[model samples]
Target chain A: MRIVLVPGVPALLPSYASIEDPVADLRAACHHAVAELGPRVRVLASSPLGERVARHLLGAAGAEESEADPTGALVVANGSAKRTVKAPGHLDERAEAFDDDLRRALVQPLPAGLAGIDVDLAAELWADVGAMPALAELLTPGTTAEVDYDDAPYGVQYWVIRWS
Target chain B: MLELGRHTFADDATLMMAIVNRTPDSFYDKGATWAEDAAFERVAAVVEQGAEIVDIGGIKAAPGEEIGPAEEKARVVDFVARVREAYPDLAISVDTWRAEVGDAVCAAGADLLNDAWGGADPDLVDVAAAHGAAIVCTHTGGVTPRTRPFRIEYDDVVAAAIADTVAYAERALAAGVARESIVIDPAHDFGKHTFHSLELTRRLGEMVDTGWPVLVSLSNKDFVGEALGLPVGERLTGTLATTAICAWAGARIYRVHEVVETRQVVDMVATIAGRRPPQRAIRGLQ
Candidate 1:
């Protein structure tokens, strides 16, 4: 199975677009990673906003949403929003380490590690991991990971990654 | 499409028509760009400053030196042709009240005839139709060209402006001018005192409500100067303030001397009025 992970950024959706793109690089990375997914992909989003973002990216990538044995799976998630003073949720000292731990897990293709994510501490740090269980189940030991984008833009940690 | 001669714009587009004087005796420039080269330079500069159109005028509006048809043509016709060749994509408009001059400029590749005199020459509309050029129908309250208002009074200035300008617009339409190509201006200081001009500026939305595209030429004019008791050179602030109001009120075209400043004000006002999005909004949105 092929898997693509993208941050649930509302700005990546067309409805919240600005005349000058604020997340041009992030958007490009998300599209590139999503395009690598097969024509029919299953979307695992945490909320309506995440679903909307995933749907837009999937549509842009010329893919359709599917659930019955999809060729690939699209996972929508993000790290801490309070990583810095300018972040959406304001500064949180614990955000950096928490996001670093999540990043290490993702880069290692250790989706199982996501199952052990500290839900209470993640919420306290403004990290959105509602879909972690599903993502953890998808992640397996033998998969090779490719990180397309990794940065804390807008004080929100975002990752565009592909695992095969 | 908002057809201007050979050019067309989307209905929602806002245009900045920069004033480029070809006459040596224009009130604001004081013959600074009277020379052809200087006028051409103004065109280049304003185009660089993001002006969508340039209103080239041969005669000054404030009781200028006598410039007959032949003289007016001598001043602008060749310049219009040169501008047409140099900037083929730019919308070139000529400000004239004479149908003879209008015919001459349109033949020389002019796109729009800005009749600031409120259809002074009945033949101007026919000329615009023949050339397939746009026409700006201004409300001058029956004032003559190259003349200032002495004691012009309207029971309701805004109403009179709307009635006269819309009538002139309908006249142009009847004369075969394209419906979308017609624009209306209230002629702020042309046939109005400071109070009349202010009232028109404040009630400009009424003009916009006519469903006709509204053009405002309130750039450092006498009304702005009189309203703030400032001289012509110092009335930019007042001009931009009024510009913001007009833009917020839904004016589509701004005939301005300071293209950059007017564009900034119009863009900011449009953004504030929810007509336009910020160029790049990431402050809280990100």
Candidate 2:
């Protein structure tokens, strides 16, 4: 039962302009997740800096940009810490599309050998996590469980997906 | 080969009957009327996605497109023969109400009959009964939308639909078709509106209660599109959602276009529901 955690990060944040180093914050979050999940962890990300941060933490050896290997784990994190923000009007659809795009970009890149992938949702966006179970069922199709990450200001929602 | 009455399916995986339109005016795949190789490629891709059955049809049972019985038989036979040769063990189901087409395809090694008319033609029933072929009885009032309105007046839609299917089953049985030779499909978008389709899906437990396997054909249907506001090409997510719900409701068969994706959805739902064992161990791991 190898586990992978993929956390969704809200990139559009009020703090993005003020923060001196977003990369440092992302690296800290990755370290926090690895330390919590233990030493045996592999993280998947779309951002080059995030991938670099993950490689530094997970000993980036033979890490490829594909999800063909099913032995590793995936963890996705959304960057926003505290905000119940709803996209205005049809922007909800765009949010959904963004969420979907992010999910596909992360999961599709995973190696098929990874046993299961888990998603960590932004705590502030819990209300926006509707129909995630169905989406997880479609994309991952294994043992799925939602976890609460209370460390972040907004409690993050985590979906743990085991391989079918 | 696993025998369903006289019909034989070589694969053990659940069959996915891809909708092949012979009519030149189908709502989604209308231009597919003359693309035999493309149709065959679709079948191959579906098979790669774990579909064990392929259903071929000549007439578009939609609003205004209807082909004659002779043309229907010719088209179906030609397609089935070509598919059978390409994939010998593939279970080919002929979608037609005419007996001649059913008879011709069954002779061409086609394994099943998917009749939307529910054995309305005696010759079709006779052909199925004579050959021991598996028959999928779907509820379509008639070929034309005018004859079969989108909204049907029934005392209890679920009960009436089940009863109608049972009655069709009885007729097929009386016509010498074996009991196991028949499967029931609620006919999700054929003359039924979105509400009706959802009602049928919600009450799918009742259909499974009939002591027969149920084939759910909600893949890329109009009701799904209406519910999710997605077009046919973009409806994969919604279609997978419906497939998951139906599998949860205990539908043994699913007729879908996205075979690999649908198979994964059904497998996951089945695993979660405990209907089947998990592919990997979930307990006693160190």
Structural similarity to truth (TM-score) of each candidate: 0.90, 0.60
Query: Best-fitting candidate, measured by TM-score?
Result: 1
* Chain B TM-scores of the candidates: 0.99, 0.90
- Return the TM-score for candidate 1, rounded to 2 decimals: 0.90
After TM-score superposition, the amount by which residue B231's alpha carbon in candidate 1 deviates from its true location, in angstroms, is 1.5
Cα error of candidate 2 at position A45, Å:
43
Least accurate stretch of 10 residues (summed lDDT) in model 1 chain B?
A: B277-286
lDDT of 1 by residue, B249-282 (tens): 9999999999999999999988888778778877
**lDDT, candidate 2, B57-173, per-residue tens:** 777656564567787776778788888888876777887877887888888877788887665676777898888788887765433422345456656667877887888877888
lDDT of 2 by residue, A1-164 (tens): 24444344332122222224333344354444444433444455555544544455455333333344434454444422222232212122233333444344334533331223223432233322322332343345444433323222222222233332
- What residue pairs are clashing in model 1? none
